[model samples]
Target: MPGVMDIKRKIKSVKNTQKITKAMKMVSAARMRKAEDAMKNARSYANKIYELVGNMADRVEADSHPFLTARKEVRNVCLAIITSDKGLCGAFNSNVVKKTLAFARENKGVNIKLICIGKKAYDFLGKKEFEVLSKYVSFGGKITYDEASEIGDKLVDYYMSEDVDEIYIIHNEFRSTAFQVAKVTKVLPLSIEKTEAAETTDYIYEPKAEVLLKEIMPRYINFTVYFSLLESIAGEHGSRMVAMDNAARNAGEVINKLTLTFNKARQGAITNEILDIVNGAEALNG
Candidate 1:
């Protein structure tokens, strides 16, 4: 059993840790709210852009643009993986890394290259045998659309140059403050699925459908990347908030146990002193 001083030290340490965790939980909660709102606002625009592209593909020929055409054989694949720059979150980064590795393992024959977006992804994948084509880290919690556009442009260049046959992105999709799921989405060679509910009315193109496609398709790809980044950021905050909340609770439990132990130790010390005094007094009197 530890002495009263040792137990007091432990209690103080735990109380300090509890304070830090509580502060972190509050900060993460505030950030999560802002991130969720940003994510919600961007989601509608991203979906509309996707819908517009799908509808346009239906009206145009298959070979209207290079992005609209699918490759006959997939030879090489590129994965743009998004993870948090920092981690205090439970399994948020680990889950994404595991999913990406599983994806790589599942597609053994194809050549896989990585475009890592966060420090976590870059650090984990960098140590592996996988080829990392590009890495971006420490965006300082603020990712701009222009930065996303740069990444998207690089992917487009890779596709156009025949460097990669397919491009996919892996990220954490924000569902709620308490829930997030790892999602993998293909962004290249643009999959066009016809929607039954979409209107069949004919529409006129201003600069011709082909010309407009050349202009807008790249924008669509950029927006997709940007939206994914936003979603991942939101998910990161949510995960961290939950993690810190749990940590604070655990710290509180530890403090309670330590306080109880301290009281017991102090009581035992007092009882021992009293017994020693009584024994000495009885011996002197005898």
Candidate 2:
């Protein structure tokens, strides 16, 4: 049984914690709205770019470009992992890391290259057994297309150099505030269907279709990376908002329980004091 003083102190502490969690929940909720809007806006452009690139790739011979060429065995594979820099977002980062690790484990014999986006991912995968090629940390819980472009540039350079035979991006796709989908996308050797879809469309080229492809293909890759980053940002904010909301609710419940305990303890103390006074008065009078 806790003393009245101790119970009061605990109740006060829990109330303070509840206030903080409530504020955090509100802040994350506001940010989530903006993040989600940004993601939705970018998706249309990303889809357009992919559709155009896929169509263009069809007009030319599949062997016309190295990027469109698919190889039999993947000697080296690069995994671009997007994660949050901070914790307290429930299991957002942990789940992504888990899925990534599972993929890495599944491809045991192949050389696994890592391109980590967040500090958490960099730290988590940077240790032994993983080859971290590049990392970009400190996006400040938000990221922009420019930051995404820099990462895309690094991946393009690596892919063109044939350093990695296959490139895959691992990220969380925003479904709703409560849900996110873990996704792994193949970045290179643009899908055959996308190319065929492009081939069927008829259009007049200004200079040449191949020339346009030279310019557009790289941009397409960049846009794909950028979109993935945006999706990741949206997912992070959504997850954080949901996590903080739960935290606030849990804090409220705790504070309520503690207050109940404090009141009981105080009532017990008062009852004991009254009993002591009555007993003393009776003994003195008798």
Candidate 3:
């Protein structure tokens, strides 16, 4: 049996740890709420833009824009992977990395290049054989449209220069505080599905539909990247909040068990002392 002093010290240490975890949980919860709000606000605009672009693509000929045309042969591929800069989110980064790795493995024959958006993804994918075209590390917590535009511009240059034939994005989609889904989506060569509304609706082009497409397609790409970044940020905060809450709860349980043991040890010591005193008194009387 351990001494009371040792157990007391352990309980004190665990209590300090519990305090830290509880503080972290509260902080993360606050951040998660802010992030989720940002994500929700941005989703409306992003979705509308996406729908407009898709519908426009359907009405226009594939040759009308470079973004609308699919390559006959896919020789090279680029993957833009979004991950968290810092960890502590339970399996949030790992899930994205796993999805990215699975995609890389599946496309074994093609030349694969990576555009890593976060520190964790860059660090993990950097060691791999695939060429890392661009890497953004420690990019802060918030994302801006300008940053997404810059990334989009580089990707457009690559596509126009024939550096890569196809581009895809891997990220986590925020569903709720407790749930996020890892998703892989192709961003380039806009998947133009012919819908009934798209086929029936026809509008006169003021400056030619081709010119309009050229102007809007780049924006589409940039917004897609921006939206994905927002989703990732929200997911990261949510995951961290959940993980920290669990950690605090586990610490509380551990502290309770340790306190019980300490009480038992102290009780046993007191009982032993009482027995010794009683036996001494009896012996003296005899």
For each candidate, what is the lDDT? 0.91, 0.83, 0.88
Model 3: per-residue Cα lDDT over 1-286, one tens digit each: 9999999999999999989888987987888888888888988997799788877877888788888889999999999999999988898999999999898789888999999999999988899888999988786767888988898888888898989999999999898887988899898888878775545668787788889899998998988888899889989888988988898899999999999999999999999999999999999999
Instruction: Quote the lDDT for 252 in model 2.
Output: 84
Residue pairs with colliding backbones in model 3 are none
Per-model TM-score on C-alpha atoms:
0.97, 0.95, 0.94
Q: Give the Å shift of residue 165 in candidate 2.
A: 0.8
Q: Which runs of model 3 end up more than 4 angstroms from their true locations?
A: 196-199
lDDT measured at residue 108 in model 1 versus the true structure, 0 to 100? 99
Candidates sorted by TM-score, best first: 1, 2, 3
Regions more than 4 Å wrong, model 1: 195-199
Candidate 1 structure quality by residue, lDDT tens digits, 41-159: 88788778877888899888888899988999998999999999998998999989999999999999999999999999998988999899899999866688899999999999999
Instruction: Let me know the TM-score candidate 2 reaches against the reference structure.
Output: 0.95
Residue 84 of model 3 has an lDDT of 93
Give RMSD to native, each candidate: 1.3, 1.7, 1.6
Q: Clash pairs of candidate 1? A: none
Model 3 local distance difference test score: 0.88
